[model samples]
Target: MVVKNLIQHLAQLAALEISDSEVPKYQAQLTDIFEHMDQIKQLDLAAIAETFRTTEEENVLRDDIVTPSLSQAEALQNASLTHDGFFVVPSVMKDKDAT
Candidate 1:
């Protein structure tokens, strides 16, 4: 039995804000989902064979062949910024010392 309080608690844990009017709506939906899961648990399927795939088609893969490609200079030709043979981008991480 999914209750309104439980739904509100779940929303809090997930960092979601729900209105007072939405609590009962979520509670009913969650209760129905749980009931369906419970019904699935009651089914007996011990004789059924476990299957990893439903389709008969097998994965077709191309042969791995090494090919000659671009040089270091060619690869970094279009970069907006380059430093010591490496592409220099803006810093993404914040400095820990600068609080």
Candidate 2:
């Protein structure tokens, strides 16, 4: 059974401020939850089998194949700004203390 004092203590532990009017509402909810848990505890499931997954679906992945890709020069050719051999982008960091 969920009592008013226990609910107040739980709220204090969780750093929550529950008003007097809300105490009865929370007390009823917590009691209902505990009653449902008690009903679950009385269930007989000794014949039930333990399984990890509910579905039989398997992952389908493709083979990792090395393919020819664009070169550095080709990649940087369309860039609006470029340094010696790399693309130059605007700085995004604002903190001076960032290393």
Backbone clashes under 3 angstroms, per model: 0, 0
Model 2 poorest ten-residue lDDT run: 90-99
Q: lDDT tens string, model 2, 47-96?
A: 99888877876665678998999999999999999999898999875554
Q: What tens digits encode model 1's per-residue C-alpha lDDT throughout 17-88?
A: 899999888988999999999999999999999898897777767878999998889989999999999999
In angstroms, how far off is 56's CA in candidate 1?
A: 2.3
In model 1, which regions exceed 4 Å deviation?
61-99
Error of 1 at 62 (Å): 5.6
Clashing pairs in 1: none
- Report the error of model 2 at residue 19, Å: 0.6
Cα deviation at 25, candidate 2, in Å, is 0.7
Assess the local accuracy of residue 28 in candidate 2 as a C-alpha lDDT between 0 and 100.
92
